[model samples]
Target: MATRAVWRYRAIFAMLCAAIVFFALLPFGAGEGGVPGPDLIVCLMAAWILRRPDYVPVWLLLIVLILADVLLMRPLGLWTLILILMSEYLRRRVDHTEALPFWSEAGLVAACITAAYLVDHLALVLLLAETPPVLGQGLHALATIVFYPATAVFSQVIGVRRLAPGELDSLGTRA
Candidate 1:
């Protein structure tokens, strides 16, 4: 049962990611309009991982991140590496963060996203890659941070909420 549930949510995560990427890539003709939009995939990935780390296997995440880089034309492994690191970071802290108040958890999300964005930007700058101005990237990070709570709520609505202490063995018995 635990394995079944994990696979089900894993599929959901993939479908949702595909839809978001498709929608974002749609030719709305806006073409990088005045401001950059929030990185919704990153927000959703972070929220889901925080809630249920086991649902998102590392190999699965790598596949998705690489797809994002190729489809979204990001700096290949650069953003992928950053996101993988962020995911692992959150995964490791899941127990501690789950116990905190919602705002505190959201703050941590913001910090992680912000740091990821900053690191990504710095790497691009050092490589002399063409990137949008810092202001634009900052806006993107801000928008992503702002949307985190909504994604966290969405995660819960989709049954990926943080496991209460009582849920132990509800997932599966410990060895």
Candidate 2:
């Protein structure tokens, strides 16, 4: 039974990772009079989904980020690093907090997503001078903010539970 459960987790993890990559590739509109593309919600969802870092290994996260970079033709290692950083930040927040309500969690998710965008987009603009239209950036940010509730609803609807007892042995009760 333990073996089956382990395999089940592995399968689910793989599926979730694939969904992240696929969703990242989707041409979701950035709103009116904008690029009408580029979805950052996937990064937030990936971070939210992997609230348990153990379930989503660093290597696997790196691979998925790399795939996203290639699919989006973005600067290599940019999104990969952003995802890793956000995941680490979220994990640390989970460790420090004694209790977190739904709204707080949703807010953190939105903040992390916005942070990732600000860091990456600004860096890209400074380094490459790409300067994507201001309207597009505004639209994307708005879309991400709007996207948060849907992700929260999805997690709740899917009965997305957190780490099991023994799974957090390394981090102790705090985590």
Query: Model 2 has how many clashing residue pairs?
Result: 0
- Give the Cα lDDT of each candidate: 0.85, 0.61
The local lDDT score (0 to 100) that residue 69 gets in candidate 2 is: 77
Error of 2 at 113 (Å): 1.6
Tens digits of per-residue lDDT for model 1 on 1-175? 4577788999999999898889888977335656677888898999988888878878989998899889988778999999999999988888888668999989999999999999998898899999878888898899899999998899899899777675752356321
Over the stretch 1-175, how does candidate 2's per-residue lDDT look in tens digits?
Answer: 2244434544565676577668756767444564543354353344444454444556666776687678768778876788788877776776543256767777777777778778878888779767667666666766776667666566445544566545542234325
TM-score (C-alpha) between model 2 and the true structure: 0.73
| Model 2 error, position 104 (Å) | 1.3
